[model samples]
Target chain A: MTETWIILGATSSIARAFIRQEAANGSGFLLCGRDMDDIAATAADARLRGAPMAEAMAFDARQPDTFAPILDRAASLSGAVSVAVFVGSMPEQAAIDADPAMIAGVVTDSFTGPAQFLTAIAPMMETRGAGRVVGVGSVAGDRGRLGNYVYGASKAGFATYLSGLRNRLGRSGVHVMTVKPGPVDTAMTWGGPKQPLSTTPEVVARDIARGLAKRRNVIYTAGIWRLVMAVVRAIPEPIFKKMTF
Target chain B: MRWKEMELAGWGRALKSTAAVARPERRSALAGAAAPAIGNRRSYGDAALNGGGKVIDMTRLDRVLELEAATGLLRVEAGARIGELAQLLAPRGWLPAVMPGTGFATVGGCIAMDVHGKNHHGAGSFGMHLAEIELIVGGEARPIGPDDPLWRATIGGLGQTGIITAATLRLIPAKGRTMRVREQRVEGWDEHIALLDSSDASYTVGWIDATATGARLGRGILEEGEISDASLPPAGRSRKVPLDAPGFALSSPVVRVFNAAYYARVPAQGRTVTRAQADFFFPLDRIHDWNRLYGKRGFHQFQCVVPPAQKDALRDMLRAIAQSGLASPLAVLKRMGPGRAGMLSFPMEGYTLAVDFPNRAAARSLIAALEDLAIAAEGRIYFAKDSLAGAAQVRAMYPELADWQAAVSAADPDRALETDIVRRLRLRDPA
Candidate 1:
């Protein structure tokens, strides 16, 4: 069957790698992002790499109004409609501390905005009755840590939303998979001290493809992250509150 | 653009430097860059490195903006890989006009080095196919076409003129996705040169056993290839070297045995076989990070092309290399025609010999000896493979160095795009 993917935040390196992999498999794409120029370049890349139909459209999470055109475009494509949410922003903790106002934008970018967009598109997936929804949460969401608890809390809420959505969408024969990737080597994680256990964007994309194929509900990119996160989640609240990592 | 501070190296892995890099994902983001640009870092030397400075990594911006199938005109971002381009265009009956040895080499790197291929004796260098370039000079993306003064300086100019944002490549027709290869074992230096000179194959190259000495010196396998209509299964999954190998993995004895085994893999009578185009063009890429096999010290490659009259001089260099007992299994000898496209392009009407050496004190001295031999023979060392050539000697090798430097200065008045190779060789200095 022909596949059409609606990739939100398509300019992310991870999203770009995923779309390229999908293009190689002959899927078309609706690359939605705020950076139209960057998104357009990715669409061109997909077309050259073998995507049948690749169109770039404007998408801004803070502006809910921008979501409708992308949905309209996705509706026009033929085949299973898949949606991948790679939209998110994490301001420096120091910046967020200095200006509490920045927290709203971060939460909007990382969580609530994409959730609302997916809610609007749920009916289309139901009408189609065959599609996948990949909501990219982060390992930071697995637990609230001192370093980036604000960002973590936003992703945690998003992950919960995805779980509820999975429960809701499973009945319609539409699958929803939550991806909690560890430190993926991307622009998102560049320049900082290297993560001891980090995987490449390409590897993350590969694992996502595998997870979707198996119809997995939730997955950790490095697999080891599942064990690592389990240990972290198991920590007692008393000690966790006193610790800073 | 996220500016990441990290240590990076050339393909050789022998030389490394810490620098700041920003990999922009779009052409628009490439603006306002006061730095050199790099793609793939496949130059094997400092040509792609900008030490203690800032540089833009173009790999992420790779995209094919346009293609005219009939005219074979392809407009692609600087970071697009050559082998990927071939894979996309081959079934459609088109291929890059020239591809360097590695499939991982990006289009921008090829143009920066003006790289040659096995078909160099016929197809010339990669820059010859360039139609136009989107060059980012001092924050502005300007189009430099064939008629532009900056064109020649940008081509094979080691990323000195500007950041090449995009380029138009004139692809050639490919008969099929596979190539028919003819292999023969050359007995010695004399026969190797004879076969390379006489061969009529569109793509021709010889694998020399740099460890061979005495009568067996320069003995190795010679391969001639031509594209065919035969449809074959695509190349298989590439394997990677998981860890840095021990230093002795490619010791002289090991290299000798490996070379002998490799040479003997071909039947004594010679034979014809078929291979996927990728395998034929980039035989070593199948093994990812093959350089690590030389250990953490990394390796250096000495590649030079001497005029036809200096064939005897080349033999002495080879003899010295064999006697030094420092050669690795990787060595190549090829006949090149005088069909280069840039001022400092490596190809010339001569025999080009490339031999890899594990980074060691003795090997460095041996490489210096080879450099002296090349200069004495009135030959030039390739910028893409050189890590040790002195500025004065290299300046003498390429007569057009002054012309190239002048154009580069005019294009980049502040020298914002000068790379480590430029700084080391003092390429901009007239004297």
Candidate 2:
């Protein structure tokens, strides 16, 4: 079967790099995001960058009904979706102190909504007995940092949920991967504060492509994040809470 | 419900996270199809697991078939333990020249990894000793000689080429039961290089303390030994590890103190007449669950060979590790011989370093830096001990990868003989 990547939030810079990498590696993809025009432009750019095939479609992660039809259309056009990258999410600190409406949108769009999409798509993949689902999480999930605890909590919940999904699906040949990127220069974080050793979107994209090829269960983008968060998580909670990170 | 877990060497110990399978007295009724034919599971990667495939449990196939005392050659079953080989051959004044640190590894696993020992600087890998291999291919039994393409693939082939049933290994005649040994301390990275150049022995190795930073970057103990016919009084009884110690027993503090003591114990002048068996083979096997001392995260054994021209790169790697603040107490440096005919063989006529580090998150970054340093220096990482190297890096490192892949494709067009390592390296894919 031809490998097809269905990348959520394809307009995002990291997703763009991933599309380019997949294309370079000879895989086809359907790019999804909120802005059809923006995604279309991005898809064209990806095709020019050497993606074998690229298409753009509008997607609203908060709306559960939007996924099945998109996936069905993609399955009809392509052989089957060999991989799905859930890169759609609200920004960290974007929902903090916001109204209930915004919080619900952020939570559902970031965690709950993607979980439901995976649940629906998983059965289709399970029947075929092979597939890879990747969730673009954040290093913020390694621990609840004060600056982005709300977003981190969502990612933490999703990461834990994916772990269970992976264990359950292991025997069935469906692989689930959680990617925790430390800091990526993306459309969402364009004007955000900088981090030491922050990586470019291309690096994250290349990592995801490599991770998929290796069937890695969890990938710390840029590799150094593995060590960085190791020390971060090892800090005693008593002392951790007292200091501002 | 869990049994204590001890590796073949008896050095590392682990509390059994799961129950140990009861060894059937003879081959079980379920042997052929029910269980996967697991040879010695010393394959550092997932070469042993066949997913839902039945495991053959070949560890019990321990038997030495033939020994030629005059020529120092031996034919053994795939499941025979290396320790048994040393025991059987040592008494007869012969030894398997290319032996891994642990004597518990099986002949099949050794060939699968194409292991190299201290004397690799002269003897090359265990594959060089291979005269022939008997294997089961497509349910048909066949014997392959060195000329066969499958033979090259089987050696350092990581068991994916085929199931090795038996092997004909060439053994070397040993001088005696003891060796003339020398231990010295090198102050810096340059001194370490000088010591390797100065040493004149059958085997030479440096135990580096990579934690020493700045001008003392590679300060550690250096040892060289050569087997001799001169017999001296025996040096006590061989240590036996009957049981595993507690899991968390090898704490950081304990390791540091041990490292300090080991460095302090290095004799400025040479010491002679150490038992060859105790000195060269299975020294760490005396303690069990030694790996568990690193705790639950497990550990990675990072080993790479640097070309002599890129000697400075090796020094830079040690310096980077020291500056990274991640200490590896068990770092060993040795001189390797010329590359063998095995297409994927790991050694070259240069220096090789094997270090074990507790798998901290920083392990990825630290190993990446080291790998990058090695790549820049025109060196290659050992595939047998690698867990983090990507397929791209591997392709960049091994130029003969295309030939190996072509051979594998020719042997098994369906790519049926696949392992996690193969998948990780994308070895089945066309170059």
Best by DockQ: 1
Per-residue lDDT of model 2, residues B63-167, tens digit only? 455666677667776777887677656656888877888777899888877888877777788999888897766545578999887878778776666657678
DockQ of 1: 0.58
Q: What 10-residue stretch in candidate 2 chain B is worst by lDDT? A: B10-19
lDDT tens per residue, model 2, A90-206:
555645565545666666767787788777777777776766788888898889877877677788888998998898777788888899998875445533555687898778878
lDDT per model vs. reference: 0.90, 0.70
Provide the TM-score, chain A, model 2. Answer: 0.91
lDDT of candidate 1 over B1-431, digit per residue (tens): 67888788998899999889887766677668778888988888898788888888888777888888789999998999999999899988899999999999998989989999999999888999999988888778898998988888888888888888889999999889999999999999999999999999999999999999999999999999999988676668999999999988999888889999999999999999999999999999999998889889899999999999999888999999999999998899999988888888888899999999999999999999999999999999999998988888898799999899899888889988878888888998788
Which stretch of 10 consecutive residues in model 1 chain A shows the poorest summed lDDT? A187-196
Q: Can you give the lDDT of residue B204 in candidate 1? A: 99
Candidate 1 per-residue lDDT over residues A133-179, each given as its tens digit = 99999999989886787899999999999999999999999999999
Clashes of each: 0, 21
Output the number of the lDDT-best candidate: 1
